[model samples]
Target: MTVLVAISLTTGILSGIWGWVAVSLGLLSWAGFLGCTTYFASPKDGIRGLGLSIVTNMSGVFWAMVIIHLSSLFSVEILGYVVTALVSFFMCVQAKKTWLNYIPGTFIGSCATFAANGDWQLVIPSLIVGALFGYTMKASGLWLHQKLNQPNSKLAAAEAE
Candidate 1:
C-alpha cells in the first residue's frame, strides 16, 4: 500500500483507541486530540515536536491559571478582560524562547484548559498523551510503509518482475 494509505489507516486506528482510553480514564479525549494536532502542526517533528507541543501547551495552562487567579482578585469584571489581555501579550512575547516558540500550541493548550474549567490535573496528562499519539502515529505509519515496500514483500516482488 502507499504511504498515504498507511498513515491514514494508522491514524484512524490509533485515534479510535485514544478516544476509548480517554473516555475510560475519565479524561477529555477532545483535549488530547487538540494536543495531537498541535504536535503535528508544530514546525519541528519527532522528539522536538513532542517537546515543543508539551512545553507550549503547558505554558498556556499556566497563563490561563494566572488569568483565573488574578481575575478573581478583582471586584470588577472588566479587570478579568484586562488581565487576559496582559497575559496574552506575555504569551506572544514568550515566543522569543526556542522551546516556547509554538504560539498556536500555547493558544490551543489555553483553550483546552479553559474548556476543562482549569482542571490542569486532567488536561495536562491528556495533552501529553495526545502528543505521544501524534508521534506514534507518524512513526508507525512510516514503519508500515517501509515494511510493505521491502524487497521480499509482495508489492516489491511484483515491481521487480
Candidate 2:
C-alpha cells in the first residue's frame, strides 16, 4: 500500500507537467483493470494474482510513455508502438499462464483512440503495436521475477531491506 501510494505520487508529479489528464485516467483505469482482472482471473484471492497485477502498472504506463517519447529522435508514433509491444511482451513473461490478461489495457486504449479519430487505418497498426509491446512487458517482468527469486542476488538483498 505504501509503495502504491509512493508510485501514485511519483506519477502524479511527472504527469503534472505533461498529459496530466491522460496519466490520471490511465492510472485509475490501470488500477481498476488490475483489480478486476485479478479478481476474475484467479481462483482465490491469492497474492500472485494481486501482486502481479499491481506490478504491471506500478511502472507500466510510465514506461510506455517514457520509451515511446524518450528513446530517440525518431517519430513519437514509432516509440509508442515499440513501447506498447515491449510492455505487452513483458506482461506475458511475468504471468506466463495469463497472457490474455495483459491485452485489455492495450486494446482498450487502442480501440478508443481509433474510435475517436475514426481512423480505420490505425486499427490494424494499433493491434500489432499492442501485441509487440505487450509481449516485451511480459518477458521483462518474468525476467525480473526470476532474478528476484534468486537466492543471493541484488533482488534478494533489496527484498531483505
Candidate 3:
C-alpha cells in the first residue's frame, strides 16, 4: 500500500512535467496508459512484466496501426472488428512465439489510439513513450516494494539510541 502510494505521488509529479513537454511538442505521451496497462497486466510479476510490456507496446501498437490504415480502404463499419481481430491475432502470435503472453498489453494500449486517431505514423513513437513510462513506474514500484519489505533495523537502532 505504501509502495503504491509513493509511486502514485512520484509519477504524478513526473507526469505533470512530461505532460508539459507533450503539450509543447504537440505529441501525446499517454503515460498513464502504460501505468494502467502494466498494473492490470501483471500485478505480481513486476520486473518481468515491465520488460515484456515494453516490447508488447512497441510492436503491438505499430502493427495495429498498420492494420487499421489498411483496413480503412474497405470503407465498411465491420472493418473495425476486422482491424481489432487482426491486431489481436498478431499480438497473440507474438506472445506465443516469444513466450511472453503479456504482450497483449501492446494491443490493449494501442486499441484506444487506433480507434480515435487511426494515424499509423504515431504508432511507433507513441508506443515507445508508453513502454518507457511503463518501465519507469515498474522499476520505481519494485524499488519501493523492496524498501518497504526491508526489516526496520535502522529505525529500531535509532529508537534504541
Candidate 4:
C-alpha cells in the first residue's frame, strides 16, 4: 500500500537517475496509485525495502519475458502491478523500508542489456552483487531505523533537520 508506493517512487527516481527503467516504472506506478507507500521507502522506514527489492529484482526478469510476447502496453502494465503487490507484502513484513528493492528492477534491466548482446553469463555476477547489495541495504536499514527512531540523538537531529 503506502509503503510500496513510497519505496517505489524513491527507488524509481533513483533508478531512473541510475538508468534503471524497469525499477523506475515500478516506483512511478506505485507513487501514482498510492500516496503513503513512499513513506515506507524512505531510509527512515527499516528493512522493508531490502526485502521487497529481493523479490522485485528476481521477478523483474521473469516479468519482462512476459512483455516480449504480449503487447508491451498490456504486459508492462500488468507486470508493473505484480511487482508492486509483491514488494508491498514484503514491506509490511519488514516494517516498511525500501533501500534494497531496487535490485530486481536493475537486474531486469541488466538482463535486457546483456541479453541484447547475448552475454547471459554476466547475470551470475550481477546476481551475486544484487544479493550483496540487498544485505547492505538491510544492514543500513537497521542502522538508520535505530538512529531515526531514537528520541534525542544527533543522528536523529540530522534526520529532523
Candidate 5:
C-alpha cells in the first residue's frame, strides 16, 4: 500500500541521516513492513500500535543485553540459547493477550535491534524515528485515499468498473 511505501521511504531517509545509529536500512524496511501489517489489522489503532511496538522493541533489546552479559560472564552458549527460547515463548503468549495488535511491529523491531548489534541508547531514537515515519505515511495514505475517492476524480470512474 501507499502508506507502507511512504513509511519505507521515510525510514530509509532517516537511516541515512543517522547512519552511525546502527539500525541498518534493511531493518527499517522490516519495520515498515510491520507497520503495514498493523495498519491492515486496524487503521484507527495505528498510533497506539506504534507506541506499544516501540516500547516492546526496546524491552527486547534490554532482554538481549541481559542475556548476552550473563552468557559472557558464564561463557556458556547453551545457557544463552535456553534463556532466549524460554523468554521468547513467554513473550509470545503475553503478546497475544496484551499487545496483540502491535505484535508484528514489536517482534520485527526487536529482531532488527538484535541484528544490528547496536547500542541500546541508539536503538530508542532509531525506533522512534521509524514509528514517526510510519505515522506520517498513514496520514499521506489517508489523503491519497480521499483524493482518489473524490466524485470528480478518475479513480472514482475506475472504482465503478
Candidate 6:
C-alpha cells in the first residue's frame, strides 16, 4: 500500500486506541487529539517536529494562563477582552523564537488549555501523550509501508507465485 494510506490507517487505529486509553485513565481525550493534530501540523517531521509541537503548545498554555490570571485582576469585564487581545499579540510575537515558530500549534495548545478551564495538570500530560501518539503513528506507518513495499516480502512472493 501507499505510504499515505499506511499513515492514514495507522493514525486512525491509534486515535481510537488513544481515545479509549485517555478516557480510561481519566485524561482529556480531546486535548490529546489536539496535541496529535499539532504534531502532524508541525513544519518539521520526526523528533524536531515533536519538540516544536510540545514547546509551542506549552507556550500557548502559558499565555492562556497569563490571560486567565491577569484578566481576573480586573472587574471591568471588557478588560478581560483587552487582556486576551494583548496576550494574543504576545503569543504571535513570541514566534521569533525558533522553537515557538509553530503558531498554529501554540493556538491549538492555548485553546485546549482554555477548554480544560486552566487545569494545566491535566492538559499538559494529555498534550504530551498525544504528541507521542502522533510520533508513534507516523513511525509505525512508515515501517508498515516499508514492509509492504519490500521486494521479497510475502505480498511480492505471493504475486510472483
Scored by lDDT, the top model is 6
Give one digit per residue, the lDDT tens place, for model 5 in 82-161.
Answer: 87777666556656655443455545545655665745565555566655555555565666656555577576689899
Predicted model with the maximum TM-score: 6
Alpha-carbon runs more than 4 Å astray in model 3: 43-47, 75-87, 141-161
RMSD of 6: 2.7
Please write out the lDDT profile of model 6 over residues 3-100, one tens digit for every residue. Answer: 99999999999999999989998889999999999999899999999999999999989999999999999999999999999999999999998888
Error of 5 at 104 (Å): 3.2
Better of 1 and 3 by lDDT: 1
Model 2 bad stretches (over 4 Å): 1-34, 71-73, 76-80, 94-161
Error of 3 at 91 (Å): 3.0
Whichever of 1 and 5 has more lDDT, that candidate is 1
Cα deviation at 6, candidate 2, in Å, is 34
The lDDT values for all models are: 0.92, 0.41, 0.62, 0.40, 0.56, 0.94
Clash tally, candidates in order: 0, 26, 0, 11, 0, 0
Q: What global local distance difference test value does model 3 have?
A: 0.62
lDDT of 2: 0.41
**How big is the positional error of residue 46 in model 1, measured in Å on the Cα after superposition?**
0.5
* lDDT per residue (tens digit) for residues 3-92 in model 4: 335434445444334334325433222221111222233233334543443344444444444434333345458776765456445433
For candidate 3, what is the total of clashing residue pairs? 0
RMSD for each of the candidates: 2.4, 15.8, 3.9, 12.8, 6.4, 2.7
TM-scores, all candidates, are 0.91, 0.31, 0.65, 0.30, 0.61, 0.93
TM-score for model 4? 0.30
Residue 117, candidate 2: C-alpha displacement in angstroms: 15
